[model samples]
Target: MKLHYSPTSPYARKALAVAKHHGLAIELVASNPSQNPAHLLAVNPLCKIPSLETDDGVALNDSPIICEYLDHLGQGPKLFPAPGPARWRALALAALTDGILDAAVPRRGQQAFPMDEGRSAMVGRFQSAMSRTVDALEGVDLSGPLDIGKLGVVVALGYLDFRYAQEPWRPGHPKLEAFYAEQMKNPIFSETAPPPA
Candidate 1:
């Protein structure tokens, strides 16, 4: 299998971390994730990073879809819960984290390279969205006895550190900091953790 990705994207990292946790080593087709080539676009309509190329030539897009496929390839612990209320809960949390990340990237893009005033508003909106999302997570259980939802939290916070540590997030949210530290013990988390540029 091959995973098309950029090393810094949290969404791409999610799939990479899952692959590591499962002890799978895929060919890393790292690329400029924002620019889609014709061949890559042929694989994913969105031309998004973290597109998985199955051995048989099937292409899968979106981190969740790719993660699910990776889990199915193994007989080990499932990253997603089996069909039940818990499954949706875990999935929903993952989706929420992804949405927060989606909001943040554009703001970072604008502030780092603003073209107009509208980009500033977009950045502000995304930043507020992230703050609210973090606040909502205040009392959520972050202890992982090895669950997919927990992995979602780890990746989300780690991504913030990777891309926006200058914009400190955990100082006012010690619970989040503590939670992230706990999840950091996993080798995959550390191995895949992005460094500041």
Candidate 2:
């Protein structure tokens, strides 16, 4: 299997971390989606990073889907829960974390342009969403084996450190901060740390 990823992409980091955790033998193909690379676009019409090409000529796009596929390929404890209340809870938490990235990535992109009232409003909205989401996550239990939800939180916080280090996210959220710090010690995360932009 081959994973098409950008070193700085948090979404790509999620998939890569899952593969690493499961000890999957996958090739990392450095790709820049911004360039509309033919290899990426051919497999994923959305031209997104973190696209996975299976050995059987199958392509999987989207970070969650790619992570799920990798989870199935391994023998470790499941990253995604089997169908049940736990599954729903895990999926919801993962979605909340991914939502933070959804807002943050575009907000970062908008920074390249001159600030306008509209752009400022959008940035403010994204900031508010991320702040509220982190606060909510502070109360959630992060115990038990690592799952998709926990991985999502790890990647989301890492992205903030990578792109929005100046923003005050860790001052009051000690639990979330601690969780992130602990996860950073994992080989999967430490080894896959994003390159400096």
Candidate 3:
């Protein structure tokens, strides 16, 4: 399997971490979407990072889809729970954390442009969404064997730490802070952590 990815992308990091945790043998192909790389464009016209070319010659895009596909091929216990309340709970939490990434990643990219009123409003909205979502995550149960939800939390917090350190999210969210600290000890996170910004 080949994975086209950016090391600093949190979404790509999620898929990479999952593959590592499962001990899957995958080739890492570094790609920059901005350059419109031919290989990536061929597999994914959207030109997204973390596009996976499976052994079956199938192409998969989107981090969640890629992660689920990798989970199916992995030898370890499943990150995605089977049909049940557990599955719903895990999916819900994953959605929340993904929401954080959705808001944050774009906001960070928008920083390259001038901060006009419209852009500033969008940034404010992104900040509000991230703040509210993190607050909601604080009271949730972060304790569990590694699952999609927990994995999402790890990636989401790591992205914030990597890209938004100046904003400091650790003040009142002790549970989240502690959960992230503990999860970081896992090799999936420790080894695949984004480089220092």
Candidate 4:
């Protein structure tokens, strides 16, 4: 399997971490979406990073889908749970974390443009969403084996630290802080961390 990815992409990091955790052999193909790489576009019409090309010529796009695919390829425990209440909870958490990433990624791009009320308003809205999400996460139990939801939250927090250090997200969120700290101890995160921007 080959993974088309940008080193700085948090979404790519999530997929890569899942692959590493499951001990799946995947070739990392460094790709820049900005350049509109023909190879990437061919596989993913959206031209997104973290696209996975399987040995059978099948292509999987989106971080969650790619991670789930990689999880199935190995003998390791599943990050996504089987159908049940646990599955719903995991999926809900993953959705919240991914939504945070969704808002953040575009906001970063908007930063390249001039700062205006429109940009500020958009950023403010995202900040509010993040704040609420973090608050909610603080109350949720992150115990038991690591799952996709936990991985998603950790990666999302990492992305915030990497790109939005000015945003004070850790001051009051002790649980989230501890969760992130514990996850960072894992080599999967430290090894695949994005370079300083």
In order, candidate lDDTs are 0.80, 0.91, 0.94, 0.89
RMSD after CA superposition, every candidate: 1.8, 1.1, 0.7, 1.3
Candidate of highest TM-score? 3
lDDT for each residue of candidate 1 in 75-122, tens digit (9 for 90 to 100): 668888889977887887887788778887766777657457776677
| Per-model TM-score on C-alpha atoms | 0.91, 0.96, 0.98, 0.95
How do the residues 81-123 of candidate 4 rate in per-residue lDDT, one tens digit apiece? 9899998999899999999899888888887888899889998
TM-score of 2: 0.96
Query: For residues 58-168, could you state the per-residue lDDT of candidate 2 as single tens digits?
Result: 999999999999998889889899999888888998999999999999999998999999999999999999989989999999987889999999999889888998996
TM-score (C-alpha) between model 4 and the true structure: 0.95
Off by over 4 Å in 3: none
**What are the per-residue Cα lDDT tens digits for candidate 3 across 41-112?**
999999998899998999999999999999999999999999999999999999999999999999999999
True-structure Cα RMSD, model 1: 1.8
Q: What lDDT score is found at residue 130 in candidate 2? A: 91
- lDDT, residue 81, model 3: 93
Clashes of each: 0, 0, 0, 0
2 versus 4: better TM-score goes to = 2
